[model samples]
Target: MAVNKLVYYIIPLIVLGLIAWWQFGFGGLFENLKGGVKGVIEMAPNVSIGAEEELATEPTIPREHEEAINNLVETIEKMVTSPKKNCFLNYKLLGKNYGTNSGMPSLGEGGTTISFQLKGDKTEMLIAGGAGGKQEVTRLRKEIAGFKPCVIAGSNEITKNFFNRYLGQGQILGDNYKPVSIINIFYDTDGDNGNAIRVPEFGNEPVNDEGDNFEDEGWLFKAEDGSICFFPTNKVMSADDDGLVYGNINQINTKVGVVGSGLDYCYTWTE
Candidate 1:
């Protein structure tokens, strides 16, 4: 009975010793078999550990950028709750270097049109001239994703201030004056077919340059090609004969695949 019991215990150890020798090496086989199969397993590395966690995570937006958006949100909220029941705001995207042409008022094809009409507490926005339009400002924020600070590409000042550059001056829309309508007329003037305002690639996150990022100082379009430029107006509405808000292309960061530096011009009240 003792001999049989010894053989049974020895058989498993012998098999384990052979496996260890074949898989690893004959050098540690004896030492490994001292603690049975458990020792060999513990010695073996766990190759599955790499898959336990994700290789990368999404980038986080800076806190200052977040604050900028909040400020703009506050401005929009006030507009929605304005006393004017027939409030209307239209946002248009024009080319980067618009109005720089010397002779005659250069006209180009309009691109990316967004309109908003106040409804009680919140304003309903229409994006891209689609049939299924009319979403609230809150929904627009979700689509914008987030904002990043403006950074010049291939430069040391990656975190430089965004509003330091020169952007042309314009009168802020006064509270006493409310916007009725803003219309942009485009003419193919030269017939070269090149004057049309280039439309930004909507629904895709903007691929900024190495130093490129964003700021929340401007009005965030639902799909403004992932950029944040200046808000066209101070008050919710504008009643000026020439209510035009031009986006400073130089002020915005470089976009990888989009034309112009930032958003185009938003024209209002010129039929």
Candidate 2:
């Protein structure tokens, strides 16, 4: 009877212990314990710990050279965003001294070059040049080709096309269309000829010498050779505010391709 009573008490205690463990065990308890230990350790400071300490040095601020470079960068950025006339004026000033025709033979011919000695890093100098003329522009473009900048080059026509066609726009357009119109159409297309022809709605036909029916419902047609041909449109063509006209050709049942006809081809109508 004594042993039975003892076992009864022991069993109840063990059951209670198991219940407590199940209710308040594992992650919560471990986290609490870890936090408490960390708190205590943090409170107990000045404990000798062996660690490699970097030799203390005075905090270095931007040197005059770096400041000058930064200022130049800012100026270039602002000039790029400014009005075309203002940009041209500034470009002229830069071009005058460093320009291709500038009397300085060291600066090369046809392009404007600007050279400044870095203020802090006195050993090195920074030279930047831009060419607006056709030959110089070509040379500059060739030099920068395949070069990637730490700071992304701001959007231009080429960059915009890359994003809209090469990157995310491909996925978006693919999802929306069954036979997705390839943005590659902007470039070359098989059976389209040399390139897509662009004819102005108000101006003369693109190919003046080649005699064709100009009055007929002319189309800015993409030839099978991947060439674009511009023809006159006899009928009234309507365009949206965005300047995109959506339409279909008789041969192709589905709508495909687009036409830009406004000033500088500003209007783009996609079908």
RMSD of each: 19.9, 25.3
Q: How far does residue 48 in candidate 1 sit from its true spot (Å)? A: 12
Give one digit per residue, the lDDT tens place, for model 1 in 1-271. Answer: 9999999999999997778789868657656555564444345523123332221221232332233334444444433333332122222222222243211122222222233333433334332211122222222332221321111111112111222222333342222111211111122233233212211221121111101111112332221122222222111112111111123332332331234433332222331
lDDT of 2 by residue, 182-220 (tens): 111011122321212122221332221112112211122
- Backbone clashes counted, model 2: 26
lDDT of each: 0.28, 0.25
Q: TM-score, each model?
A: 0.22, 0.15
lDDT of 2: 0.25
TM-score, candidate 2, is: 0.15
For TM-score, the strongest prediction is 1
Model 1 alpha-carbon miss at residue 106, Å: 30
**Model 1's TM-score against the true structure:** 0.22
